[model samples]
Target: MNKDDAELARFNALARDFWDPKGPMKPLHMLNPLRIDWIENQYGSLVDAEVLDIGCGGGLAAEAMAARGAVVTGLDGADKLLKAAQLHADDHQIQVDYQLGMAEDWAAANPGRYELVTCLEMLEHVPDPESVIAAISHALAPGGTAVLSTLNRTARGFLLGIVAAEYLLKWVEPGTHTYRKFIKPSELAEMCRRHGLEIKAVTGVRLNPLRALQPQPFELTQNDLAVNYFMSVRKPL
Candidate 1:
């Protein structure tokens, strides 16, 4: 199989346990509360807004956004994950549109449609990060805001995200992460700028030892390029 096929296969394999609270992804599950809080603090209330979640695996963040009163649409390239998200949403009686497609493809098909677009923990897995960013830009309304979270290319990030999380804690599957695909904050920021989005805020996300088993609130720091960073960008008004 080619690169895309291989990645999709990995995601498919993980889909069964993606939403299981006791699964390998429990660490990410634990981070849900903190992620939701950070997203709310950055975007304010999503009440009555149209929100798009790119690469929204298992609908964790998407459901959080929906709970906050936004019309949430979750998109993913993995079919099994999308199916799981749909089932989970149905089980909760919450409405979310789960689409099976790449971020760029969906964005191209529906331009200037979303008030808020979120691409979290996904850029590293894609083949063309810039194209994905461009799609995100196209999907947002002129004044829309985009929130992104991803690992950085640094010793700290590698050690924490790959070594500690994957190897030590077993938070994810083995070989699920590759250091070469990791991106730097500068590169992400530049991609956003090139796609007609202005970088509004760049904040580092920390993992507290106490809350290491669960998601804790991320403090805004001047140190944007860290182990993990959350960035808020906006298209011009």
Candidate 2:
């Protein structure tokens, strides 16, 4: 289990608005559908699949999976965020097992239990991303897919993802991302490689703020990974 105290505290402070589409998590709300579409495209249906969502703040992605017939378990290191997630899940009458724990610890306790593991936008925040991915590998069922998303470490990432997002436009909460912790696609693939997982697909995520219809319009791009991107990794059978 790798917990970043400051990051935990930051999310805890914003727990109350974690589910609010117009609030601190608005960007995620906008990005969720695109994310789900991309993941489902790669892995197909989630019907009746056992899913583990690490760093699942406020249950956005977890609820989406559950709605698509996935038996989901949401995990987070922050107690406050977990409480908010539970409350929101109950409010929506969606069944999700919300737990407070680190990714490494939870994976150790529940090995080979999930057909799908999602650690989106969280690897950078964790103090030890390698440990978390290793745990995910151990926890995942053979041939199961692991979906991960994070910012690439590049000038474009620092410019668009961080500077423009956090300081310039304030689309996300300020200080949401740390440049030093950002991981490029190659680095992430290597992490998965070390855990015996094979990279299946790599897709970048782009957000256009200047669009008139929406402040944040996101799309998946194949040739561009200097900003946000998602990768699907598969464990050999």
Candidate 3:
């Protein structure tokens, strides 16, 4: 049962210091607030909403959502990462159910469980992303919201996400990504549609490379989505 074993191993190997802001996961730490802000602006404050954070490596987004009053569950397929998430949540007194298992399998066993489903920077790493999307649809309650972010399959994506981030800047480990796995916005919209999710907004996620170094905020935009992008989807009532 290898649902992307390489990816699981990759994150597992980096799990110990996943919550450290100065570690390999620092990029995610910087990107998380922007993700949370966009979610709040689009989905409204999650007070009392049932939320699921898929591929929730170290509880960054999960804790943020819990802070906004959402009853949250953080799911990851890797054991080490799940432990890191649990420890981080415990240290902050954040109440998030940290679970370790495949998202597809977990969603199969827990259908219609969440009012909001978030899969961020994760779809690209899976061997069959459509399976993950279908699983998320099952996990989401009818009329729930699904927000996903991933690398775009574009020239700029190859240059920036791969060339610049992994190689030149060394912000991420070498061979952390493959260009073929990146998803285009159009492809993602179609995949969501097939799973009963209506596309609402597609926004470009931009963080100045300097932010990864100097520490600063990022931006979301509809103007450009050549590298990284986020899309909000909804299950029809």
| Leading candidate by lDDT | 2
Tens-digit per-residue lDDT, 66-165, candidate 1 = 9889999999888998898899889999899998887777887999999999988888887778888999999999989999988899998899889988
Off by over 4 Å in 3: 209-213
Clashes of each: 2, 0, 0
lDDT of 2: 0.89
Say which prediction, candidate 1 or candidate 2, comes out ahead on TM-score. Answer: 2
Sort by lDDT, best first. Answer: 2, 3, 1
- Candidate RMSDs in Å, in order, are 2.1, 1.2, 1.5
- What TM-score against the true fold does each predicted structure earn? 0.93, 0.97, 0.95
**How far off is residue 86 in model 3, in Å?**
0.4
Model 1 clashing-pair count: 2
Q: List the pairs of residues colliding in candidate 1.
A: 30-215, 31-215
Write one digit per residue (lDDT tens) for candidate 3, span 42-98: 788899989999988878899999989999999988899889888888888889999
Candidate 1: where is the Cα deviation over 4 Å? 1-3, 210-224
Taking the tens digit of each residue's C-alpha lDDT, what string does model 2 give over 1-237?
378899999999989988878888877888999898877887889999899999998889999999898999999988999899899889889999999888888888999988999999899998889998999999999999999999999999999978888877677888999999999888999999999999999999877556624845887889888899999999899
